[model samples]
Target: MREDFLHYVWQQQYFDKQNLLTETGELLTVLHPGFHNTDAGPDFLNARLQLGEVEWNGAVEIHLRASDWHRHQHQTDARYDQVILHVVLTADQPVLRTDGTPIPTLALAGRIPLEMLHTYQQLQTAPPATLPCAPFLTKIPEITRLSMVDRALLERMERKSATVQLLHQQLDNDWEATAWHVLAAGFGFRKNTEPLARLAKALPLRILRRHRHNLLQTEALLFGQAGFLSAANEKAEDIADEYVQMLRAEYEFLRHKYDLENTGLKEHEWNFLRMRPANFPTARLAQLAALLHARPLLFDALLSAQNVAVLEQFFSNESSVYWRTHYRPGRAGKVPALGRSSMHLLITNVVVPLRVAYARSVGQTEQVEAALQLLTELPAEKNHVLALYEGLPFTHRTAADSQGLLMLATAYCQPLRCVECAIGSRILRHNSALK
Candidate 1:
């Protein structure tokens, strides 16, 4: 009984259209139902209709009851004066203009098929589930599902591109600096993105570039800025380590040289509660330091990377010698380098978005296409959400497919927006027709 259902029914011509008439028994012919208005004013605008022997063109308004016009006080609003038709589910009262002229009314309560009503009701009243359309997903055509997923993937990319655009603006359109911040955030993964981004912001690329020639200086700057170089916080064993003492000394000199001020991101800001040893913040920062030292022109090289293999190679550099067998400064143990899975995540989240933003800013259509092509070349992501759609009609073979499924789960299914989703719309239409 929601007004959105009525809008859907009218927009799709789901109700019986034969021998249409108004409540006063005048023949009504809809030349055009008008575009549905999502903004303020009428429910529809620029409608062309035939009222008996006369042709009319204006806005159209719909309500669950004709009396709702008065309840909503549209009679006093100047915006509703041009409405040529007031279509309601029930005509409980007459709607008039300011000049005392009666507006044509159409009641669709009896015209809508009982089957359509039943189908819509079932979708709305169904018990809570992962996806309202999950039961009927297989019933939809494969082509229809594929088309929807394609659109969803683009939608997700567009949203991510917007974030990059905002960062670009904040950095005064500096692509390199924006990419640095973005890459730093990506290295943090999901658990510590904010702290890593803060670290990047506190220590600009210019500062890091100055010390790029010496990998130890670059590591000291990054680790020092992250508040991880404090000797007081380290264990006695770590304090006795020669490498830790060297970094502490190097950071002390750099801190004084740059006149840097800590941005209050202490060691506690990083989350290490249940994360794998390889994904520890200390290890990630070491990898980031190595990347900075190896690729002085990180953004430039990424932009010129011809394919996924080249991009993977760009991030394949190993960390410093001290990090080869340690996840943290105080913890010394054999730890693996950045794995392929982590690299895939960085490419998907950081590299692609950065490329898309830069390409869009510089008006390079081919680069944008190349960035999206990289995602299609990469393997699909495995996550809890993807597990929900494991045996669905579509195959998630690449990052593009997984991204599409993520968008579908979050934007469509999670919100129960069945009417707006293509798969849900098709299911509803089929069920309604069957009824």
Candidate 2:
């Protein structure tokens, strides 16, 4: 019933071909259906067809109703003038070109198979459900489902790596800088990623490189650039804290040295309300400072560490004495170092993408596969979106599978794009409901 369904039927030749006729009863012969166009003009282009005793080559346009030609005002447009045939589900009215030449109409109302419509209607008109195909998932074969999920996981990683590629380009093709920015964003977790990335961009890797050997100076640059060195960020009682005062003094000196007076983030750019204290941006920044201070080259470390265990050990010690004792500067509390799950997330989000981007840049195709392989070794991410499939037939359980399910939830299920999904297509095909 939908225009896209009609477009699908037309493109796939789903309707009968025995003794074709345009509504006026001129014998029709479709030598070629033409290429489907997605742009602003005709539905199909460069079509070769035979109408009555004459042969013609032009475009073919499809509409659910012939009256839609007028509804769309294609009669006045020169773009539609090239249309030699108007294929519609029903011929409600006559149509003409810009110069008043009659374009032939082909009505496919009775020609299309009924069962196909029944299957398509189910996919297109499913009720408000998170996964509309959930009811039919049991009908989809295991191999088909697993293959699609694997494809989705690769697609999700590719999408995530695209952001890495853009960062690499913006950082003048420096993989080290790109890795730093990616790790900074990953450290932000979910809420403060943009601000953290902005902070990293403001304080470039070159500047961080000079101070990496000295943890205090590195902390000074990160905290100062994050706008935490300002008095507004300090509590009244904490003003006399010797450690906080020392960092502030050192940041002021560094700020003046690097001429970075106006290039720092505001506190409002970070999100602190409602989230746990451990997940605070302040705690995350301290963790990031520790990583940069210990690891001189982040991208090189990623290249050298192929396995997940190596990467796990590398991210384990991301805390200094000050960070272990305080959640934020001038605040007296115990702060936990990055946990196993947090480290897994950083490796999945930052390390994997960094590997893939670097591999593609250097034309090392196998390294990309090795990078994606890391996901399979890590534990699956546990979240509400994935929790929905707990009792279902989806048996694949790894970070790859979790990522795939998340991708499938957003990119296919949420959009109700089942007709194009592999599982949905197989269900329809196996039931003799589709071509």
Candidate 3:
């Protein structure tokens, strides 16, 4: 059996406690199980145990076999010196302190109920599956499932917030600049997120703000940094269109004026394979340029947004005039404007994460709550992961719900961490008593 299963049993006090004895035949009573230590010192800390008539307080260590203490070289390490009890699945050998004093040992070989072992075996030995607990998922109480979903959503937000915090640190705590970088990455979507992030880093918010009032110049800076304006090199003779010529000429002037460098970001870094035409890098960059031109203080505006509707309205801007009929520099077609679904994606992934990060950095508790509330207002994201939970007892009505399902699928279900999941815990708790 895995040590984690033993940990679960010991932490929950699931074994028979009617009569306990040490290997030396002394009566043993556990007054306290102690705090389970996740770090290196011991398995549990500050345990209070009553041995015979005397009470002892110290750390407790667990092992599969009593001989493992020596196998792990705990005899040579002072960290195990304070261990008051050696709890093992099998006491195959005696253990002693660094001073050669014999330590009390307790074997849980038969103390754990056989039914519980069967339940654990089912969870651990299940065949390869996406949702290991799927067979018993519907049996869990609705309230328990909902609570786990809520917890999963919060975990996702906390993880995203940590990423934002890292970005904020990288940007030297410039919230607006960090927001711009994150928003650009979001605009890139999955196919081109890294390239878009590189584009934002190469063209700083300060440079973009300098030309924000002039949309053409702002577009020129973005396109130039993204290596789009360099298309004039190979297709010099074909740059007959005035708009392309203007952007090329303007980018050259701005590139020289601001002493800007592309920082090795090439046009080829963008991926267009199998992506929708509207999601092409060219179209996305143009949309981003339009947003940048329109909103110089986009992060500030998002922070002041009292609700999701206001945030939606804030993002409701079409691409620049030149992009109305063009998906790329030379290609011209009726490309769709940024749709509602894409807008929701940006709000959920970019704006909310940014808001949460900024709120946490500035210690504004209410803003963090408001930012999370925005997820509840937006519709749930549609993806294969969320699709796995369709027709299940739970409902996916908002981004929060979708995020929670995504977390469950990736973190818990995919890893077969049934013992750690609330639903899985309940299923095992109920079924452990059945044969």
Candidate 4:
């Protein structure tokens, strides 16, 4: 069994604790199992324990084997000196603190219920191809599954918020710039997120705002900064297009005007191979330019969206007059403006995260709630990841539910971190059957 299972057993007091004794034959009475510590130092902190006639309050460290104490080199770390006890599944060897004091040891090999261990072992042996906890999914209470998914969703939003907050701090607490960078990265969808983020950072929002009133100039700045308007990037056929030539000339003048000649990206930094024409970086850049030109207060517009319809309308911009017929730089292809699914994705990724980040920055609780409320109004996302949980009762009704399941699948299940999952924890505790 894994070390974490031992931790769970100890935390929940699932193991037999009557007549407990340390390896040194001291009567060990656990007054308090202590708080489970996730950070560095000990596994459990502030433990209140009774060793014989002595009452000790300190940390408790756990390991699969007693030898793990030295294997982890806790003997040298002074932080572990506070360890009042070393609780292990097997007490094969003794341990000492940095001061050479022998820490009391409690072996739990036979103390824990055999049934629980067997069940957890069964889950660990499940086939990896399917969902990590697929077999025991139905056995878990529906409410429990829902609650865990909600937690996963919150975790995802918070994680995204952290990213946005970091960007906000890096941009010197500028919400608009943070929104711009996040939106630019989100517009990349997945394939070109890094380059898109880099492109956004290189071309500041102020520069884009300066030229937003003129659509051509706005597109020129974005396309130019993204490395698309450079001569080395231009295809032989695209060189003769009037719009392309005009854009190139406009970007050169704008670049020189702004003294940004050296801050442009290479054309090869973008990804276009095997992707649909509509979702191409060039097309996405065009849509971003349109959105920037349409709304000067873009972050405000996103926040003030009353419902999904209004939020969706924000992304309904049809780019430019020329883009109505062309999808890429010089490509002769007709692609629709952000499709319904694509718009929904933008709301889910860009709008939701951006709103949450903004709300948290100003410490507005209602605003944060309102930001999350938008997801409940939007349609559920349909993709392979959600499909993995097809038969489960995750509902997948709205973007919120889908978002929860997506977070669970992408973060917890795929990584085989079942021991840390609520559903998996339940299955281990109850020995739920597999499909």
Candidate 1 deviant stretches above 4 angstroms: 1-3, 19-27, 37-43, 52-54, 61-107, 125-129, 231-235
> TM-score of predicted model 2?
0.89
Query: What is the Cα root-mean-square deviation between model 4 and the actual structure?
Result: 2.3
* Per-model TM values vs. the true structure: 0.88, 0.89, 0.91, 0.96
Q: For candidate 4, lDDT tens digit of each residue in 227-297?
A: 88888767886787899899999999999999997787888889988998888998899899999999898
- Leading candidate by TM-score: 4
For candidate 1, the lDDT comes to 0.86
Give the higher-TM-score candidate: 2 or 3: 3
Using lDDT as the measure, name the better of candidate 2 and candidate 3: 2
Query: How accurate locally is residue 31 in candidate 2, as Cα lDDT from 0 to 100?
Result: 88
Across 1-435, the per-residue lDDT of candidate 3 in tens digits comes to 678777767766778777799999989999999999989988999999999999999999999999999999998889999999999999999998899988999999888888778867777776754456667777889998999988887788778889999999999988888888899899988789989988888888898898899989988888888888885343643276678889988988989888885462776777989877798999998888888878878888988887778877787778887788888786777778888898888888888888888888889978877888988898888887777788778778998899888988888877777667888778767765431
Q: Which candidate model has the greater TM-score, 1 or 3?
A: 3
> 317-399 in candidate 2: lDDT tens per residue?
66778878887777778888888899999988999888888888889989989999999998888887887677789965789
Which regions of candidate 2 fall more than 4 Å away from where they truly are?
Answer: 29-61, 66-85, 92-103, 431-435
In model 4, which residue pairs have backbone atoms overlapping below 3 Å? 135-434, 135-435
Better of 3 and 4 by TM-score: 4
